[model samples]
Target: MNVDFVDSAAVQDLLDRASGVRTEGGDARIKAITRDLIEAVMRAIVKYDIDESEFWRAITFFQNGAPEFGLIAPGVGIEHFLDLYMDAKDADAGLTGGTPRTIEGPLYVEGAPLVEGEVNLTDDADDTGTLIMNGSVRGPDGEPVGNAIVHVWHANSKGFYSHFDPTGEQTPFNNRRRIRVDSDGRYSFRSRMPNGYSVPPGGATDRLMSTLGRHGNRPAHVHFFIEAPGYRTLTTQINFGDDPFAADDFAFGTREGLLPVPNRQGDSASIAFDFRLQRATTEKDEGFSSRTRATA
Candidate 1:
């Protein structure tokens, strides 16, 4: 059967009506995207000799399987569309440059204890080694952002995050905290150094890494998420100053400015770091909601 003879004009009419019907407030952008997608499909059909069956197959694959694939697309840069848009807006408004933003991993949980000055994050462990992380949350102009809320979390000595470990206790999320910076914009915490850990080892992410001949070992580092009223939220990691893989994090999140200097002595160590945050200009730049209390 000659499906092309069914009329391209009628197909286009149906697409146009579908786009109009799906439109809503703030949907002018969506309509434009829909028009572009339809135009691209029409062009592909004509230029690439894509038959009706092939076109329908592509649509079916996207409809049935794309959502699951989309969840992991951010790891490969496809999810940067929103970040790119925000970056452009920030550049236009002169709200640029402090520390580059990175993707938040799947392990962030909220509602750890709110400690005063510092808390030994590894209090349960028997290791006597102490790590003190102190930093000032500064704005783009180099001014301190006082009273900022800084959330810190990391894998324990065994490279396992709380809530994700099946053998762990079910209390408030483990190895996490919401520390408020003092008037001097300084906050500190104590936690034992973490050891490197591999990825899930058999999951889809691990499968891809194996095919690429890569190891999924993440180096020892502490995770920090800082948010203040007028400052843009910062999600970053502080790499152990002397870890072997400090220069090459599995997640590729290592930045020159993020590595702090470690002060190590007999069974004790401390690290001091200063964090700089960008000023938030719009409401869209506000920090995300906390998920710490939701952990089982």
Candidate 2:
């Protein structure tokens, strides 16, 4: 019988040479890392007695699922990274807070109907109440922001938005309008005070929230997306004057400056508020639309 010894260095040299082979314009480092990861996964599959077909299926699932990770990043908490970075830059320049920023929800439609002065947003005939929202857009120096476009939308008195409510009518996107501020940077609108709304039952987002043991209810609030040339777009909400959730918004959008003092005179309710926008220096700071049109 003869004992044979293998040259470990020769095998290592072969591996080192194979690792240098380029794939998809990737260098040796990437190729080596890819090979190592593949080997580790294969070893895991063998050790765990995972089904070969299921293993490949899981790989396919992960290949498709990985992009969703980006949603959690820039679209979610990871966006705080950029926010913190910007805050640091502002702090260095001694720019303190004027208005707190909030997440821009995906529901915002582009290019909403533009109106002058005021418009009624309440939809149902049964809904009757005197609610007035008046505000002016301002600059950093507290100067009026002329010609500002203020987009306002909210749920109906029943806590149901138009597009989402199957029982609602067609025209007048319920509680949604784009009003151009006057030369004095003033705008007002009339609508019934909207009720607090819960997230739709049995949806992807709702399911996730339920699994996380979280309630998907947003406090009664009015949604506003204000924009003007040479200014940053401001997306925010003014909580209901007397809602219990005012201090406990599920979205964490409530800020000290966002709370509006309700001024009620007889049967009419009024909210006089002011918004300050950051001046835009670049072409990208122009503005964004506030409407959504469905495709046939």
Model 1: per-residue Cα lDDT over 47-158, one tens digit each: 6778889889766755664433422344344444545666687789777687655545667675677776766565455344566677688887888888788888877767
- Weakest 10 consecutive residues of candidate 2 by summed lDDT: 1-10
Q: Cα-based RMSD of the predictions, in order?
A: 5.5, 8.5
Candidate whose TM-score is highest: 1
- Superposition error at 82 for model 2 (Å): 6.7
User: Estimated TM-score per prediction?
Assistant: 0.71, 0.67
Give residue 147's error in model 2 in angstroms. Answer: 1.7
User: How many residue pairs clash per model?
Assistant: 4, 6
Could you tell me the TM-score of candidate 2?
Answer: 0.67
